[model samples]
Target: MKMFGKVDVGGGLSDFWAYIREPRPHRWAVWGVALALTWVVFSGVEQYLIPVDRPKAQIIYFENWTADRSAGEIRADWIARARETTRRNARKRAEYQRFADSLGIEYDSTEADRVTRETLGEEAAEAVKQRPAPPPRSTLAERAARGPQPEITD
Candidate 1:
C-alpha cells in the first residue's frame, strides 16, 4: 500500500561519489587501488568462474580402401612411397647444403644422407619386427559348428 514511502537508505554511495569527485592528495592512490581491485576481480572471474568453451578440434578421416589389396601390391606401393620420400629429402638436403655453403657453414650432405638412411633403415627393421601377428582365420566348418550369430541392430 505504501509504494512511494520515504525509505531511509544510507548515503554510502553518495559519499563515495563525493569522495571520488573531490580532489585530494590520496585521491589518485584511491583510484589506483580501486582500478587494481577491479582488475583482480575481473581476472579472477575470467580465469576461474567463467566457463571457457574451447572449440573442439574437428577431425576428418578419408576412407582408404587398402584392405582389399594383395601383399605384393602393398609392398610395391610402400617401396614407391619410400623412394619418393628419399628423393624429396635428398632435394631438401641439397638445398640446405647450398644455403650452408653460401653462409660459409660446413655441411656434409652425403654424410647426413648416409646417417639418415641408416637410422631410417634401422627404425624400419625395428618396426617390422615389432609388427603384430595377423588374426587367426576361421574355417566355414567352425562357423557352422558355432551356429548363426545374432543380428547387430543399430
Candidate 2:
C-alpha cells in the first residue's frame, strides 16, 4: 500500500485559485479571518520571542568624595568644575555653529555665547543661594542629648 499519493502542487494551486474566484461573500470573510489570524499569530511570536532594543545600564560617577579636604579645597574644585563645564559648553556651541554655517543657517555665535554665560552665571548664583546653612553646634548638642526618639506612625 502506497503511504502517499503523487504530489500535485499545481493542482492544489489551481483549486485555491478556483475557490478564490468564486463569487461568494463568505470567501472574502474567510480571507479576512485568515489575515487577522495570521497577523495575531505573527504579533504574538514577535512580542514573546523577539528581542527588543533597550537602553544599556549606565554607571554615573557624581563626585570623588574626600574626608580630609578643607573648605578652600572644595571651593577650588567647584571653580575648576565650573570652568570645565564652561569650556565644554563653548566647544559644543562652536561645533553647532560650524554645522549651522555649513547648512547656510545664520547663527550669531557671540550672542549665543553671551546668553549661555549669563544662564550659567544665574544658575551658579541660584545654587549658591539655595545652599543650606550648617546647624549650630548647640543645636547638635541638644539633639544628641535627646537621644533616639520614637518613630511616628500614621
Candidate 3:
C-alpha cells in the first residue's frame, strides 16, 4: 500500500451532476404558481386600499383668523395707532428744540439774517479781552439772599 491515500474528488462532483440531470418537472410548475399568486394579491391590495399621490400645496390648508373683522374697524385701529406715533415724535422734536435754544444756538431762517464774524468786528473782541475777571468770592449777603443751603444728614 502507498503512504498517501488516493483522493476521489472527480467522482464526488460527477455524482452531484448526475442528480441534477434527473429533474422533477412538477417542482418548477409549483414555484411558478406561487410567484403568480403572490403578485396578484399584492396588486389587488395596492389598487383599492392605497391613496394616490397629490401636490403638497393642495393637501395643506389655512384659515384667516381676522375673517370676522370689519373694514371700518381695521381702518379705525390703524388710524389710532398712527396718531399715537405722531404725537410721540412731535414731543421728542419739541424737547430737542428746547435744548438747542438753551445752548444759545439761533434757528435763523434766511442766509442774510444769520449772524457773522464781520458783525462782531475787531473792536468787540478787544473790549472782551480788556474786561477784568470777576472775583471768585461769594458774599454772605448773596448766600443769605439766595436762602440757606440744604443740609445733608448723611
Candidate 4:
C-alpha cells in the first residue's frame, strides 16, 4: 500500500518505525476493548467498597483530626446554666423571706451586726425574743374600723 511507509526488506531502524506506526486495525480494537474492560472493573470496585458521601466524609475526617468540641462554646453553655440556677435560687430565697415576714418572724440580722451586739449587752439581746407573732388582722372592714396599720421601721 502506498499509504504505508517504505518497508525495509532488511530488518533496520526503518522497520522498527513501521512496526510502531502501522498497527493493525485488529490490534487497536483489542487495545480499546482492554481499556474499556479496565474502566468497568475500576468503577465496580469503587461502587462496592468506597462510599461517595463527600461532604459527610469530610466532616467526619475533620472531627477525627481535631477535638470533638469547641471549648468556648462549652464554656458559654455552662455560664448560661449557672446564671439560670442563680436566678432561680434568688427568687426562691425572696419567696421564703416574704413568707417568714408574713408569719411575723423578723430575720435576726442581729447575728450579722457584731457592732450592735457589742453595744447592746447580752441582756438587751435576750429582751428581743421572737417578737410575738402579731395577731392576725380582721377583715377589710375591721381594718378600716381599726385605722391604718402602724408603720414599724427598722
Candidate 5:
C-alpha cells in the first residue's frame, strides 16, 4: 500500500549506470572507490573464506604395505619345514612340539613363528633362509591374522 523505505532491491544498478553515463570526475571517483572496495572485499573473501559445500576432510588417509605385520600367529609350518631342509634342523620339529606343549595350544606355524621371534629372539626370515616357503594355511583365524609373507628372494 505504501513505499515506506528506500529498499530498492535492484535499484543500485541504475545508480551505477547513472554514475558511468556522466563524465563528471566526482562520479568516476565514486565509481572507482566502489570498484576498489568491492574488489578488496571480494578478494579478501575469496582468499580467506572457505566454501560451505567444500567436502571437509574428516580424516586424512594413506596406506603403506611395508610397515604391516601379522595380526595373528605367524605361520609355524614354514619354519619347521625350513629347519627340516637342513640336516641338523629336524630338531626344530621337537622345538615345535615343546613350544606347543608349553603353550597348551595346538602346534601352529603362526604360533611357532611367534614363539621363535618372541621367545627365541628370531625373525621369520630365519626360517625361510634361502628359499620361499609354501603359502600359509587357509583357516579363518589364520587368514585374518596372517600378513603378506616375504618372498625368499635370490
Candidate 6:
C-alpha cells in the first residue's frame, strides 16, 4: 500500500469513532439515570406508604395490662426475711413495720415469730398470719389514661 491523495470513506467506522470520541449524552444512559432518580425520590425519600394503627394498638395493650401484684408480694417476702437477719435488727425492723402498717399491711413485730419464720418454712409462720395482701391501689379511671398516641392515622 502506497500513500496517495485518495480518502478512506467507506463503512460507518468514521461515524462510530466520532460518536465515541465526543461527550454527547446517550439516550439509554439518560433514561436509566432518570428512572433511578425517580425511583429514589418516590420509594426512598417519600413516607406514609402504609399508615400505622398506633392508637388502637396502644389501647389494646393498655386494656390488657393489669396492676402487678408481685411487687407487694416481693416486699412482704423481703420483710419476712429482714425480720430474721439480725445485726441491724430492732430499729430498722420497727421502722419498716410502721411503714408497712401505714401502707395497710399488718407485719409481725415479734422476735419469736421472726425466729419461727426463719427456722421453719412460711407455712409454720402461718400461726401469726401477717397480712399477706396489700391494699389495692389505682381505680379503673386512672388506668384508662395512657398518653396520646403519636401515629394516630385515618
lDDT of each: 0.71, 0.73, 0.60, 0.62, 0.59, 0.63
lDDT of 4 at 17: 72
Off by over 4 Å in 4: 1-67, 108-154
Stretches of candidate 3 off by over 4 Å are 1-65, 107-154
Q: What is the per-residue lDDT of model 5 for residues 1-154, given as tens digits with 9 covering 90 to 100?
A: 6775667757788997786797875876787899999999998888789445677679868874335456342356455555445324334755665666655556545554454444334444465343343343466778668877788989
TM-score of each predicted structure versus truth: 0.38, 0.33, 0.27, 0.27, 0.23, 0.18
Clash pairs, model 6 backbone? none
How many steric clashes between backbone atoms does each model show?
A: 0, 0, 0, 0, 7, 0
Write one digit per residue (lDDT tens) for candidate 1, span 38-72.
99999999989997999999999897756689999
Per-residue alpha-carbon lDDT of candidate 6 for residues 28-109, written as tens digits (9 for 90 to 100): 6876899999987787544566555565434333443346758888787777676556424543665686688667676766
Q: After superposition, how far is residue 40 of candidate 2 from its true place, in Å?
A: 20
lDDT tens digits by residue: candidate 3, 1-154:
8755887889979997787567787867876999999999899889867867866765657874478889998887787676566446544544554555656455432232122113334653453345344335566788889997899997
Per-residue C-alpha lDDT of model 2 across residues 49-138, encoded as one tens digit per residue: 896988999999786778899999999889878778876776686677667766656766666566556647666445434534433344
Residue 43 Cα positional deviation in candidate 2, in Å, after optimal superposition: 18
**Residue 12 deviation, candidate 2, in Å?**
25
Number of the top lDDT candidate: 2
Report lDDT (Cα) of residue 92, candidate 5.
72
Candidate 5 Cα deviation (angstroms), residue 25: 3.0
| Higher-TM-score candidate of 3 and 5 | 3
Error in Å for residue 46 of model 5: 1.2
Cα miss at 85, model 2 (Å)?
1.2
Error of 6 at 13 (Å): 42
The better-scoring model by TM-score among 1 and 4 is 1
Give the Cα-based TM-score of candidate 2 against the true structure: 0.33
